[model samples]
Target: MFTNYHEAIEWIHSRLAFGVKPGLERMKWLMNRLGNPEQSIKAVHVAGTNGKGSTIAFTRSVLQEAGYSVGTFTSPFILTFNERISVNGAPIEDEEWLSLVNEIKPFVDELDQTELGAATEFEIITACAFAYFAHVHQVDFVLLETGLGGRLDSTNIAVPILTAITSIGHDHMAILGDTLEQIAAEKAGIIKEGIPMITAVHQPEALAVIQNTAKEKNAECISLHDTCSFDEQQPTETGERFTLRTSKRQYPQLETGLIGTHQRQNASLAVLLIEWLEQEGYISVTEEQIYEGIRQAVWAGRFEKVKDHPPVYLDGAHNEEGIDRLIETVQAHFFSKKVHICFSALKDKPYKKMIQKLEAVSSSIHFVSFDFPRAESAEKLYVCSHLDAKSYDDDPRTVLEFIQKKSDDPSAVILVTGSLYFISDIRNRMIG
Candidate 1:
């Protein structure tokens, strides 16, 4: 058993050596040994290429306002590793993490000796979240965000009461597939038999894939476009304000602290999910609670402004779809201002295309490599840009200094984006 927090965390991270083994066989085996904790909670399985975390954040906040405890299991933590297994937006205590890791370590060792081989880092983390939610700190609802494609992702072990796919786009092409339809099929794997599914996907081909999977599973799928709609959307000084029209009701002046119109879509998904929960008799909430929750909800790295006086905004626009949304948000909110972008991304991502989209909107872009193993070189990222206002620095501190100096101009809107890992690092440097 581990005696301290750091040792336990190190051991957990060490399993990264196993990398991303996609099947759930090892997860099933581990969960079975752990008394099948995943079955003990009412889980909401969320899968998508982007916006999964934001959607889960919106849903969790609404449920919390409705007076239900919500547990969230998400990947690539923004600030702390403990945030991956959080309840009510607060991360689990280190003591709880230590206890959970201690309890699960033996099963991990035993699973390693089996033909199933060692559990990957993600599998172990997923198992820990299940056990913690079921035994250590049980909650009314648990939202499981898929780490990768849905079909074989470790989080798929849960049989969720509700399923949601936020969007389908090109990401992890090597594993999930290179085409939108193929990727959509993999994401649709979360739709279980007879379970009601919700999605914000509008792409005809992608929507068809999810709809077909839901039909095959005898699940009733609701697309945001088909049932719910939002309009009069406008960016607010603090966030976004939009009017949502549902099949049964119209919610005008629905506001969220999270920025962007894309966020309005994510917030609407949360609203619809809560409505379904209420209609199905699983939970009850007032209209005021729903309104207040939407207004109060905020996610960390999606167009989050960490500093003032030049306004350093951090967005995790690592993929092609994500970059497109970020561009839209920038154009929508900061159309009249000068937009300066500081960016970095994983080498495996489609950074070339992302850079092209960013270059279109950015007045100047600084490419800096961070401390991740798969992070792209600043020089290579610089080479991809055709814009005259581009610079690269291998050392991020040097770039940070330059950004701080450039922010002296009140009209300059500083944006630090590209990868979530890079955003997390920059956020810590700027705020913490």
Candidate 2:
């Protein structure tokens, strides 16, 4: 087994490959060579442009509350790599992660030798999660979230009991597709034959595409809007208290640890999925456990409050829809306070539209570039945002300093947003 976290992560990162390699030939080969660990357990596959993580969080929590040992695998870790693999709602320990990586490295290497090439960063991570859940933790169920568009994503390997698509939006246009209908088609690829597919409320065009795809695949499709509704009241210092009402169940006074109105919809979808699972006899969780799970569950780096004094808010609003939600939440909660913003985004993102949204809410904007190859230059961001603001160095710390100086008002809120990578960087700095 690997001796340390650094070695394990480095070994995985050493085999990074870019771009889409459509078809599951490579993933199927790799998993088979590793004894097909993914098949040993049941899974719930989630895909979407937005809110997939939150849906996963809710699904996992509900299963865990049902007294089943659940394993959750999601991408783009906010603070630590260990966050990608969790069992029973706790991140896998560093020692366990290293050991798991060591166990899976040989199979990954063998795949490389046979001309499949080493798995992508996301592919390797997905493999690790499956092996950990199936072989190590021996989980009763595993919740998997797609890394990107689902049609060709590495995580699409599983034949899940239920497939879910959260709210669809226009992000990753270059890699997925340019139009909403095309993107919806790609996201809808997770619908396997006869598998019950659950979806959040989607645009008519997107919904039509998804419905057609599910019909073509012979998958039973469940729409969240048709099954569930929510009532979000004003936010308090503790957080937002919302009521989740489904056709068969009602969770009144449901308070989420997560912020924003969008989360209310996410929670409703989670409840609906759990209800569906229970009906199918896949799992059985009590109403009390459901309430507990919603109250205690936490998904970091999405509308998370990092500081109280001089109020700092961190959200990974990397796309137009996400930015809109961030703006709405900020306006509702901190409308009187001037907003100081720190922003960055991947080159492939709709940076121009994202910038426009931020410009509408931001009192001052500071741009910074992350170390990733996909990150856009700070100068480009500043120009595209069309804000006459002073530029800071590419360094995240330097940008944070600028925000600190500008946000002198105790009531003023400093919002660190625009990209998940940027939030990851800030999270690293804060902990260090």
Predicted structure with the largest lDDT when compared to the true one: 1
lDDT of 1 by residue, 1-432 (tens): 899999999999898888889998999999999999999999999999988998898888889988999999998899999999999999999999999999999999998999999898999899999999999888999989999999999999897999999999999999999889999999999899999999999899999999999999999999998988778889998789999999967999999979876898889988988898999998998989889998888889999988887787899988998999999899989999999999998999989999999988999999999998899999999999999988899788765786778766978999999889999998888877
For all predictions, the C-alpha RMSD in Å is 0.9, 2.0
My TM-score estimates for the predictions, one after another, are 0.99, 0.94
lDDT of each: 0.91, 0.82
List ranges where model 2 is wrong by over 4 Å.
Answer: 1-4, 17-20, 406-408
Backbone clash numbers for all candidates listed: 0, 0
Candidate 2 to native Cα RMSD, angstroms: 2.0
Q: Mind giving the per-residue lDDT tens digits that candidate 2 earns over 1-432?
A: 567889898877766654456667788987887789878879989999989998788777767766888888888888777888988878899988888788778877777777666567777788888888878888888888998899898888897999999988878787888888999999999899999898994698898899999999999888888767667566755456877788888788887768887877787788888888889887778999888887676788888888776677788998999998888888777888888888888887888888888888888888889899789888888778677764645777876686568555775788889889889888778654
Clashing pairs in 1: none
- The local distance difference test score of model 2 is 0.82
